[model samples]
Target: RVRNAERCARFATRSSTRVKHEGAVSTVQVSVLLPECSSAPSHLDSVLNNFSSFYLIKKLPVYELLDRHFLETAVYHGAVFGLSYRTRIDEDNCVALMPNGHLTLSLDKDSFEILGFEGKPSRFKHRTATRFVVSVDLTDSSMAPGRRSYLRLLTSLKSRLQLQTDFLLSHHPGGGASIQPLLSRCDWSQHRPEVNCRVLTNLPCPAPLSCDPHSFLEWLGAVDAGISCENSSSSFLSSFVCPEPNTMHRHALSVSVSGLLLPHDIHRLLQELRRYVEQPRLASWVSMTVRGFADSPVSCSNHEHGFLRGGENFYTLMMFHDHTYQLHLAMGAHDVCPP
Candidate 1:
């Protein structure tokens, strides 16, 4: 696993350099979240509170200089570094100590676990860091399992380190309900899909807008039309309006499609829409009422069909109806049909 992590780190470094040379925005800002610890170390705590932990790699004189300093500092402190980076809107760096006690690095490819800890291992050939935002997690193991301690420790180091720039501590959820409320209160401009999707998925639609539902439907249809024109194979798999009689309430509608569209394609579209929704320049009155389905079937006829694939056609229709009905209940505020 360690070997794989090294490989990933190397790849990321290379990719980052390519992006930089391409004249794209090369600077990335990272916010580290640390778990609360009962007995935090003073040096660690000092690091956590400091703001210079974030640094720009471009400002460094040489890669070897920084690499040597990083290694020496880490070894002197007897700590393991959990490397992370932001590549694109949906892709971000995340490394963890897995449950089985192996170090795993999730770096744009399949995660790799570290196999050994000693000796001068082969360096993963990649670009050097331009800057770093480090942080540590120090929550007690008995209270917080996994590498929460490591995360907390990193957070602390991130705070005090003067290597790059200031460290930003990401918002951490206290509980299930806490997430939705926190998301609701966030400044959308600061929302990154990779970091916030899990929270957003659980959040209920915010208070509905006062726009005409029919007008909104028309706009969505036009957008769908444009998408279809751009990609001919795409089709409106299924779409329906809520049947409930409530006219004052909002409605939830979905359209499903199946084609050559891969999961990555769908994900890209969703990410684009998310950015649009977060745009503060847009009118606050405008709201996004649609969600895309990619990897998973948009609508399934029967719940059982999901588990059994023999009657695929029949179950697919059933699932669509089920989803349609549920939308009615949630948006129209009436359980008029079965989801």
Candidate 2:
């Protein structure tokens, strides 16, 4: 019997809205709402310094994915990281391999069937058999060197269309240097995640303790997008305003890091944000957001992530000084509710 079967809540076990419906949204939004706690954990700065670094793989081959040496070093270390840089359109062919060693390939019908691996038809905007997904576990024992499954995929990637594309790769603990072998085979460049910080003056902030997660996140999104929130409902341009029961922050700090960010680093950032709220300061709260890779093979956990018009899978955490927090995890329609 499933443990805690009787204790399961309707929210966790119920059929998810994401799975049953199709929309412009195709992501898994699962937030872990946390109760207020008292203190912050230490060792934040050290963790931040060790965040994974991103790299560029120019003209990387599909068969090189089976490189035993590179796999043994980086992938085996549990630092899976790879994704195609997305343009405004035609990003459907994008490939993303998460640190969990899941390689997700978005393909057309010909490529999907020709590659001939186990994959499912895409759920987004696909009334016909147009798009497909091939999600393979690179770390699986069956995928080991020279195995039947491994060779088949290698042959498909090598002898088929001979696919090669630009990829952004990252590694944790060892950083990008760990994957140098793969980079040596092609034109590649290394990059670190860009961090930007700013201080806003006279900012309208929803009450840290009172605001709902969805509305608060919306407000934060507006801030990030630099849209004027003073508009009224009748305003033709935009109608976004602060949530009710709000407060004013004469001074607020905003820091953003962008790149192929890994989850391990995000967890460290969360720990640091909690500490910021614990300190005695004018600000009563601190908010943080972690956006998932749109082309991520797995969303929330192992569940498949799909993309439509908007592959929005992300969560915003509002942590109040009282140790209470509201986490809003949002996903698009082509995913299960996030865990």
Candidate 3:
């Protein structure tokens, strides 16, 4: 999981692609941890401040996404990340717009019946088959504006289902320009990714690379949540403690961004993190965790995502001072393996 500093660029390139894939589906939150650091550098702060802004369309009609002009200008130009806001994966119907111009609908049996689209049953484990997944590739020849499949979906959504929900949407390469046509038609508001920073003093932490995966993640999670890890194993309130061979860092920095985040923004952040490490510094490592939208219809690389239990889909990347890196990708029981 670790690579030499010399191969950091190559490694970063590969990893950035992976993160982009995940982000393309939907990213709600990204958290970064810098142990033994008191403050963020100017460049790093700039990257954090400049994360892309996304739009929230209030009660956007599902068929509007299929509009000929909107598709040509935005979705086709580059990846457009869209998700049905406030929709719960386990209960309510959900929609996802993938980077490859695919529109996915996770619907319950009744909803699927009403929508009347050709789709497969849900892949996640369920006591009974009560859900279905309808995926339409907008770029397919058959889905061309006047084609049968295109009209079929357009009719189903526009007339039959009349699906309208608050939508969170963002695009790369084109940003607002590409999506302007779509946004102009809806009641929408633009929002920048919200950034939060925290400085911790005398924090107990384990050596990230040397600690066991489970233990280190547990410790890191505790730290991120501002939980006290100074507990005995037998303590009833909380048994969590810094792993052995740990050191007390005089100070550490934690920064997080929450919103409809894009891959381009994340890649830039990673580059800044690498740049931070390349400089002469006391900290030997930094960690970043990107969490996908729990209700997304797809996870990394367009894998079918479900919420059978936890609905967890996320990855944690740990970069060391030597340019070596470790990546841990995980998904919930309802999803396939992460890429």
**Candidate number of the best TM-score:** 3
Q: Please provide, for model 1 over 268-293, each residue's C-alpha lDDT reduced to its tens digit, 9 standing for 90 to 100.
A: 33333333323443122222222211
What are the runs in model 2 whose C-alpha is more than 4 Å off? 1-51, 87-91, 175-177, 232-237
In candidate 2, position 42 carries an lDDT of: 41
Candidate 1 TM-score over all chains jointly: 0.19
* TM-score per candidate, chains pooled: 0.19, 0.80, 0.91
- Ten-residue region with minimum lDDT total, candidate 1: 313-322
Identify the leading candidate in terms of lDDT: 3
Candidate 2 positional error at 111, Å: 0.6
Candidate 2 residue-wise lDDT, 1-339, digit = tens? 221111111121222212111121112121221212222224543544445666788878867877888778777776657777652112446576666677778777787778887788765534587777788888899998889998888888889757777877767665556677788888988777665545566777777446655676677887776666887889998888899887666665555666777666676566666666677766666666667666664566666666655656676666666666555567766566644
Worst 10 residues of 3 by lDDT: 1-10
**After superposition, which runs of candidate 3 have C-alpha atoms over 4 Å from their true positions?**
1-24
Q: Tell me how far the alpha carbon of residue 120 in candidate 1 is from the true structure, in angstroms, after superposition.
A: 15
TM-score, candidate 2, is 0.80
lDDT ranking of the models: 3, 2, 1
In candidate 3 the C-alpha lDDT for residue 54 amounts to: 85
